[model samples]
Each structure stands twice: as C-alpha cells, then as structure tokens.
Target: MRLHHRLKEKVLESVSSVLPITVIVLILSITIAPLTPGALILFIFGAVLLILGMGFFTLGVDMSMIPMGEGIGVQMSKSKTILISLAVCLILGILITVAEPDLQVLANQVPAVPNPVLIFTVAAGVGIFLLLAEVRMLFQIPLSYTLVFFYAIIFLMAFCTPDSFVPVSFDSGGVTTGPVTVPFIMALGIGMASVRSDKNSNSDSFGLIALCSIGPVMAVLLLGIFYHPSETVYAPSEIAVIATTKDAAREFLTGIPHYAGEVTTALLPIILLFLVFQLLFRRFHRHQLLKIVSGLVYTYIGLILFLTGVNVGFMPAGQHIGAAIAQSPYKVLLIPIGMLIGYFIVKAEPAVLVLTKQVEEISNGSISQKSIEHSLSIGIALSVGIAMIRILTGISIMWFLIPGYLISLIMTFFVPQIFTGIAFDSGGVASGPMTATFLLPLAMGACEAVGGNILTDAFGIVAMVAMTPLCTIQLLGLSSRLKEHLPPRQPRAKEEVEDCILYFDAED
Candidate 1:
C-alpha cells in the first residue's frame, strides 16, 4: 500500500519534470526546427518511457540505495577501524562508478583512450576522493578548504594537458556524480557523519560528491597528457536519418538490450555490495531486506527503460535541432534556445530531485527545494547559453572555466558553508545522463555546423552545465545571509517600534 502511494507521487513528479521539455520540443518543431516525423514519434514515445522510468527509478532509489548506503555508513562508523573503513569506501566508490551510464556515454565519445581505461581511471579517482570526503567528515574539516585545495590542483593540471583533452577531462568530473552513484555515495557520507557528534557533520556529508567530481577531472587531465588526441579525428557525426515512424520504432527497439545490459551491470555490483555488507553486519531486518530487494528490482527495470529511451529517442532529435538552428539565418538564436532547454532539462534529471530534497531536509527548510530548483535552472540556462556561444564562435573553453571556478571558489568565504557544499554538488547532479544524452549531442551538432572543433568547442557543454550553478547557488546563500544580518529592517515605522517598546516595558 505504501508502494502504491509512493508510485502515484513519483508519477506526478515525473510528469512535471518531463512535460516542459516535451512542450518546448513541440513548439520548436511547429515553428522553426521541425523534426522528421519518425524522429518526432520516437521523441514522443521516449517522453512516455522517461516519465515512467523516472517514476520507478525515484521510488526504487528511495527504498533500496538510500537505506543500503546509510546502513553501511552506520556500520563502518561503528566498527572504529580507520583502515577498514577507508578500504571499504575505496572499493565501494570504484564499483558503483564503473558502470555509471553517464560515464558510459562519455567514455564512448572520448577519442584515443580506450573506454574501459577511461572508466577505470574515473572509477579510481572517485574511490580515492570518496576516501578524502570520508576523512574530511571524520575530522570535521571545513568543506570549503578541501574544495579550494583540490580545484586549485585540477586547474593547475589543466594548463599542462592538451587543449583537445581539457573539456572532456572536466566533463568526466561532472558526469561521475550521476544517478547510479549519487544516492548511495551521498547517503554513505550521511552514514559516516553518524559517528561525528559535530554540528557541521551534516554539511560535510554533502561535499563527497563535490570532491569526487574533482578526481575525474585530474585523472582525465593526466590521461590527456599521456594520450595525445589527433585534432581532426574528433569531428562530430551527421545526424541520424529516420525516414518513417517504423524506422524510429525500430531504432528504439534495437537500443533496449544495450541499455538493459549497461544498467544491469551498473546495478549488479551495488546489489552484491549491499548483500555482502548485510551478511557481515546484519543491519537490515528481514522485512526491510525484502523491501530493498523489491526496490532494487524497480531501479534495475527503470534504468534500463530510462537509458534506452534517452539514448535512442532524445540524442538524434537534440543533434538535429542544434544543426538546424546553426544552419538557420538567425543562428544567434541558439543562445536563447539553449537557455530555454537548459532551464527545463535540469528539472528532469533524476539525481537533481534527490539532491534538492536532501538539501531542503538538511537545512530544515531554510533552503527550500523550490529555491534550489530555480537556482539550478537559472545557472544551467546561463551555462548552456554560454556553451552555444562557444560553439558559434569557436572560443576556447578555458576562457569560461578558469574565471567561473575562480569566482565560485572565492564566493565560498562570503556564503554559508552549507550552500557552498550544496552548490558544488549541484554542479554534478545537474549534469546527469540527460545532459550527456541530449545537450552534448546538441552542442556537437552545432559545433560541426559552425565549422568548429567538436573536441574543444563541443565537449565542454557538460562542464558549463556543471559550472554556473556553483556561483549562482552560492550567490543565493549570500543573499540569504545578508537578509539575516540586515538589522531587523530598521524597525519599519516609528509607531511599530514604539509598540514593541511598550510590549517589552509591560513585560518588565
């Protein structure tokens, strides 16, 4: 009965998440960038799948991954063996990240480096950084200092790496904290915080994703130094040709097994890890265990469906729309279009919902979920708009990234510490599989049409989507902080102040 109720709620959330994108696409098609009928049909079908898939995925993660991760964290904290705890976090990080579907999308796109190697490199980076986050939480260190330290290292490495490799490297970081990894690892941080009776432990729980994001950037930059990519080989491909609805239907049908395998591989290790940990600690009782197993089943099925639809239905349309707009007379329109898409697309990200709700709960409604959502949308809109400009003009990604990170990091001192951590984590959550599947392809298509380097110009859309939020959300924190310190609005009116004085005098 509880599951039934949750299912209805999730379905409502999914519709709200997906419906805007559908409407935007429809309006674009009718007015300026009409999709081929078959592609249109595929996109329509994909939207249906996306809504159902997200609904199931949200409910499943709530039931299974959250509990499993928190339980492990609690047990690991109880054990009091630092070495063992570090080892477990390390192993857990690599395992969960290896099969991340977002990472898979990125791995397939990067040239020269083998996909498995890229995956492994990113997985290891995540593990190492997850270890760092755990240590930071255990010691109750300020999250800002850790972020500044690692990001400084990441930027310094960027200067040494090949230009062709920089954007992809940064994007790797953004994609690592995706749907499969975010919930468990984030909950893992929460669980680890259980041992620390400090006031800031909850805030510290959030930065694991932020630190883990940096690892992939550094790892990929190092990989780029070793593996030089040829400039010409990184060109984007022509959009897919879909002659009929039958062809689009076939395209989606063909994609089901590939994503099925990918999502199954992604979920398998997590299931095993949960099982092994449960056996060792017996944290979950029999009824809880049954519920978790049931949730895992939902997660697995939902992911398979979600991935298949996004890759097959969304990618081609996004690319075609980008190419069409790029080739149109008023090509600068890509900026507003990109902005609109970015604004709405983030609302559809599954991990985003998880992060926002957690933030609201953690801050005790001081940080509302609505505020986070709006900040994320606006940040992502600016980022995507900047990305489209980059593609149109062939500007180096460094021009945006260097200043963006510097401003965001500098803002850390001015805002609330919790917002800084949440803002940085928001960067990764906002750039989940949806960005990888649709937005990057859109940029690639536009880059190709504008005669730009797809490698340098096109690839950093994810990084941009990941970046702007750090500044925007922290600015939000700054705004709230100022409001708190504004000296009670100067007593508004003299009469109002006199009434307060009279009340106090009567009490005395």
Candidate 2:
C-alpha cells in the first residue's frame, strides 16, 4: 500500500476505536454526570488527538520498532557466545524501561518511594526477568511452569509485605508493560523464536511479556518489605480549570513541550540502541534505514501528541465525571457505568491494538482479531465492575485478586500453550496508558467523594484490569481446544449426502 493510503487506514481504525468512548463520555455528561464545559471541551479535543496519535503510532511500530526488535533478536540468536547475548538483553531491558512514560506516571502516583528509587528498581526487575525469559525460551522451557513458580513466590511475598503496598505492587506490573515495552518485547520474542525449528517455537514467542510483568510486581513487593518510606499516600492528578476556548487551547499548547520532552526521553534510549545494533550488525540497507528513520520520526511525534492529549485533556474530565457520579444519589449506578466504559476503553489502548494484530498474524488468522477484542472487552468490563464494587464497599483488593489469579493460573493447564501465553500478555496489554490516565483518576475521584481510603480502594483498578484477561482469553482457548477435539460429523450414508460430498469435492 502507498504510505498515505496506509496512514489513512490506520487513522480510520483509530477513529473506530476511540469514538465509542467519546460518545459514552458525552452521554454521561448530559445525563448522569455533567462535566464542566472546559473539561468536556478538553476531552473532545483529546479524543481527536488520541485518534491521530494512535494512527501514527501503530503505523510507526509497523515501520520501525517491530523490525528493529526482530533484527536485533535474530542477530543475538546467531551469536556464538551465550554470555554476550545475555548481557545485551539485560542492558536493553533496563535502558528501555528506565524512562518509560508509564513507569514515570506510576512512580509519581506513589509518593512513598522516591521517583528515581521506584523507577530504577522496576527497571532492574524488568532487566533481570527479561534475561530470564530469554533463557527460558532458548532452553525450550515450559512457560506455565515458570509462571506458576514465580507467582507462588509473589503471593507469599504479598502476605508478608505491608498492606498498603499490595495494590501498588500489582499496579506496577500493569504500568511497566506500556506502549514502548510491549511492541519491542513481543517482536524480540518472535525473532528469537525464528531460529528454533521445534513445534513450540510459536507458542514460546509469547511468554516474554508474561514473565516481564511478573518482575515489576515481585520487585515492588520486595520494596514494600525492605524499603520503608514514611509516606504511603496517593497523590491524585490536578485537574486544570479553563474558562474559555483560548484557555483550553493554551492548556494543550503548554502541555505539548512537556510531553515532547518526556517522549523524547522515552524514545532516545531505544533509538541509540537501534543505532548501535545497526552499526554492529549492518542489518538494514540504505532504503530500509531511511524508512526506519522516517518511522522513528512518526513514533516520536505520535507519542508526544498521545501523551499530551490523555494526560492534559482526558484526565480532568475523567476525574470530574467520577466525582460527580459519586456525589449523586444514584451512585449505585457506578458499577454498570464503569463496566460500560471498560468495554470500549480497551480499544483505545495502543498496546492492545498492537497485541491483537500480532496475535492474528502469528496464528495465520486461525485466531481472529475480533475474537481477541471481544474477549478482552468482556474481561475489562468485569474488572472495572469489580473495581467499582471495591470503591463502593471498601473491600480489600486481595479478596478479589487472590481468587482471580488462582483461577487464571489453574486455567493455564487446560488451555492450549499458545493461548496461555497470549492470555497473560493480554492481561498486561489491556491496562496501558488509557487505564492509568483515565480509569485510575476516575477511581480516585469516586473514592475521594465517598470518603474511602484512596490507597486501598482506588489504586487497584489497573491491577484488576490486568488480571481478568488472563482468565477470559484462556477460556477462549479452552473453547477452541474443545471444538478441535470433537468428533467430526459422519456424512449421512444417503444419496443426498453423497451428492453434497461430491459437489464440495468438485468445487475444491
């Protein structure tokens, strides 16, 4: 396809993805929760930017990040020495993660740990686990066993860790695997798997994201145990007040520079790493290199626009709506309302789009993208409903999380191996910047209105969003497995049956 043609297609897809949420918010504003004019205007503006940003971002990933990651992974697989590949993977993990925008948002939310402290700790955790993931894939190890073992350790630590930190720890896992991390990690896994001629190579390419998610949770839980910070308070985002169109425009314009810098910081390390790999391996020709550079430029601009829109434009609207709903007599509607929003909101997550497309490609259309989308939507709806329940009743997050994880883990054995990997990865992908920028703020707003403990009640929405996909997608896989095993219908031994079989055979 021509470049302009492709870009248009992507933008249109983004529109389909973002439009539902926009309509939902608009309806809520008119009926149940009236947003300030300024906030509503900002939200409409943000939704437009979100559509454009996703368009460019997904196209850029197709043009650059996926190729770069796959090329590097292929080269590493060809390396004669194991030590060199391991060292390189560790460095790549840490470098890419340290300045991740999602991780920064997460760090800022938790005032207890210094930003640098939490950021680096989570980065290190990703680095170590990424290395472990590579080894497991290379050695042909089963993904389920590793997940089962690590999760056991994680839950044990959760029991010992401070109560306030449990939700944050799980939230950390969701935020760490954001737009920047998922594409590269997933592509790298595919490249690594390409070298293996075994039957499990395709399935093995999937579990890297699953393992990487575990690291942050485990690391944060350990931090809770040993690193004692005096303040464990949660700081909600400050919503901007705008009185006129000029002020709204000014607000977004002012945000551009800040987000540009943040996006630059996030992309710089990946660019540098890509350059180094290109120099060492000479992987791309002149035309390919030019294309990659163009793609990088698209990625840079797209991310800046995306971050600015969501953080500046959407955050305030989400907060105000939640607060308004919570204060009203009809607060009981929060559960169904949240579920409705969650159903469409996952489509707006950039990483989720990347994951669904990749799954479809890898499965050669055996697993349709529509099916994955529906499953994730169902899962997120349930999760957000659960989160709403927690906010209303002030229930312990552990009460839900324990059973959810246990069920997801138990389901892993019954599903196909490929589904197991995709399920866990979807869990991470479903809870990206959209959940953080909008859903978390929404939860916090409602929590504050109800006079509940924000740390305990509002903080675990992302974790819940992350957890449900593991079970729902696995259930999807289990259904497919059963269908495959069912006995084939015997052709009726009659003239009509013979004629039908003969007709189909003739057509073939």
Q: lDDT winner among the candidates?
A: 2
lDDT by residue (22-76, candidate 1, tens digit) is 8999898887788888778878988988998899999999889888888998888
Clashing pairs in 1: none
Model-by-model lDDT, in order? 0.87, 0.91
TM-score of each: 0.94, 0.96
Residue 266 CA displacement from its true place in model 1, Å: 0.4
lDDT of 2 at 262: 85
Q: Residue 366 of candidate 2: its Cα lDDT?
A: 96
Cα-based lDDT at residue 168, candidate 1: 84
What stretches of model 2 exceed 4 Å from their correct place? 490-508
CA error at residue 366 for candidate 1, angstroms: 2.0
Per-residue CA lDDT of model 2 for 1-508, tens digit only, reads 8998998999999999999999999999999899889999899889988999999999999998999888888888889998898998899889988978999988887788999999999998899999999899878888888888999999999999988889999999999999988999999998988888889988997988898899999999999999965557778777787899899999999999998988888889989998899898898999999998988888887888888889988899888888989999999888999999999999999989989999999899999999999999999999999999999999999999889999999888899999999999999999999999999889989989999999889999999999999999999999999999999998677999889999999999
Q: Which ten residues in a row are the worst by lDDT in model 2? A: 228-237
- Misplaced by over 4 Å in model 1 are 231-244, 490-508
